[model samples]
Target: MHPREATAARLLKISAGNAYDPDVDIDWDAPQPPGIMYAPQERLSLFGTPLWDALTPDQRVELSKHEVASIASIGIWFEVLLMRMLLRHVTGLDPRSAHVQYALTEIGDECRHSIMFGRMISAFGAPAYQPAAVHRALGRYLGATAGGIQTFAAALIAEEILDALQREAMADDSLQPLVRMVSRIHVVEEARHIKFARDELARQVAGSSKPRRLYCQIVVARAAYTVTHSLINPQAYAAVGLDPARAGAAAWANPRFRETLRWAGSRVTTYLQELGLVEGPARPVWRAAALL
Candidate 1:
């Protein structure tokens, strides 16, 4: 078998053993424990801002709920785009190939994850927070046009960032049980998906010409900016009874939140930098996104 096929075959076997049905695995009906934050205190966008200090402890916890719901909503949005990109990726490829089969399996995993996110949003009684209109439209464009390495790079940006956050949440005993369980499930499953994307991306980048690699870099950087900026929707602030405009501005300007963005993105940025995918014009964009 080709080396790519060998890698895919290994992933496929691992996926077979590790796949989850979130609906069955999560206790959807379990009551959310009182006083528990939905995410880490430091992870909140308004953390260390005056806005954060003004809120009562209970209000801070509520804000965390809205923020986590917003993250899950974005996860659903990105997973849908990813599934579309994966379908585009498999077009004309041999359906029986291990690569194609693993891609299909990953799509199925994303489908469950989207549904799981929707359920979590419902459980929170929070509106499904969406990206701003312009970012939503940009995501649609990228979903249709992103191919090869661009697709995998974009996937890694969203996956690894969320994975980092979820990894922390799952291990935090102070968080809501619902959040912990959900994060645990997602973190476990996404590990395989991340490995798959990283492997495929390295292969594609290795074979790509300078021009194509540059194009992928620019596109992926812009997508990274969009994802980071859209993560904590202004609506999450609104949900917590704050002025959306001011809270959103604070988050963008907050040094603590900016540091959080860097921390969340550090792993993927290092990988992309090593692949030489973070150079050229993309460097400034990555810096602007606070992912450099």
Candidate 2:
């Protein structure tokens, strides 16, 4: 077997023993502790801005709930994109191979994760935040066309950013019980998927021709920008009775929020930089996305 297949074989065994059914594993009926925030205050988009200072503590907690829902909504969106891309990825490959089998396993994980996110949103009593029409169109395009390095790079961008935040969240004892449980489950399962994608991405980038490499650089950078910018829907602010436009402007301009973006993107960005996929025409886009 090739080295990639060997890695997948190992992953498959680990998954067999460790995969979670969120529906069964999570205590959906558990009582949430009152006065707990849904996410860390520092991670909230408007956390340090004037708008944040203007809100009462209760309002701040409310905003965190909505923001967590918005993030979960985006997670569902990206996982759907990932499911489609993974299907396309294995279409022409040997189905019996460990690599193909692991890809399908990941698809199963993503499907469960999407459902889990939807349930969490409903539980929060928040609106299901959809991406803007333009971004939905871009997602459709990427799902249909992204392959190899482009596919895995986009996967890493979304997964890594969320992973960074979730890792912190799961360990924070002050967060809502449900939020912490969900984060812990996701973080454990996603560790395998991240390794799979990172290895596959490195292989693809090493073997890709120059023109294909350049195209992937720009395309994946655009995806990174889109995903980063869309995580906090302006409508989330509106959910808490704030002006959507004003709150969004504050979030985009807030230095603390920008720093959070950088921190979240740092691991994946560094990896992609080493692979040469985050450079050339993509550098500015990464910077503009506050992910450089």
Candidate 3:
């Protein structure tokens, strides 16, 4: 095998131990709560809108599941990208070959994640797969950009922010056992993924021209803000048979939702702060954007 392929195989072996087969591992018949099952305030606060109050308890449960699944899907996609990038870097292989391999791996991972989430919805008989409009748009925007350092920086921000959520979900005692288990497992692997992204980004940024570096930073920050805002998808309300417009407006106005929004925002803020990107004008932007 090519060295990169060997590396990927090794990583796959490691991941297999952590691989959760939803069909066999997750109990699809678990009892679900009837009311809104809020994630910890910290997790919810990441949004700018008041999603907590706008949602009925049951709706909240459905939205929460969707949120988790969204993150997992993103992770699977990131790995697919990473594996392709690695192949190009290591073996001088055609990018097409790398892309093909990456696509296969991503499809498999996404399928498993979808099944795991689908089973959770089955248990509750609730729809838990609402695609947040903002998220879709932001994803498309990022996809349009040339994939390189800028993409890597955005991925770094995204992974760190998500790691915070996964960590909280794993540790929160109120979560269902299955939910906690999934969160714990995801966080473990994601740590390595985030480190790889950050290190790669640092190297890429350092090697770029100063102008390019600044531009990349600006794009990354803006992308993070846009994606964070998209987290409050109005369509989620509609999935549970609620009026999307009213629920979206109500979610924005609700104090509880605001609180959760702030909580979630802090995770991103904290990550930026650690990276020294939260100073000067960026400070106010972070504060304003982080309403949870």
Q: Pick the candidate with the highest lDDT.
A: 2
TM-score order of candidates, best first?
A: 2, 1, 3
How far in Å is the alpha carbon of 169 misplaced in model 1?
0.3
What's the TM for model 1? 0.98
* Tens digits of lDDT, candidate 1, 25-129: 889999998888999999999999999999999999999999999999999999999999999999999999999999999999899989988999999999998
Off by over 4 Å in 1: none
What is the alpha-carbon lDDT of model 3 when measured against the actual structure? 0.54
- Clash pairs (backbone) in predicted model 2: none
lDDT of each: 0.92, 0.93, 0.54
On residues 173-224, what C-alpha lDDT tens digit does candidate 3 reach at each position? 7876666766665567655445544555555655678666556556566656
lDDT of 3 at 62: 64
RMSD of each: 0.9, 0.8, 5.8
TM-scores of the candidates are 0.98, 0.99, 0.65
lDDT (10s digit) by residue, model 2, range 1-292: 8989998999999999998888898888887676789999999999889899998888899999999999999999999999999999999999989999999999999998999999988888898998888889989999889888878999999999999999999999999989998999899999999999999999999899999999999999999999898999999998678999999999999999999999999999999999998888889999989997
Off by over 4 Å in 3: 1-19, 33-38, 41-111, 118-124, 128-137, 238-243, 253-288
Using lDDT as the measure, name the better of candidate 1 and candidate 2. Answer: 2
> How far off is residue 113 in model 1, in Å?
0.4
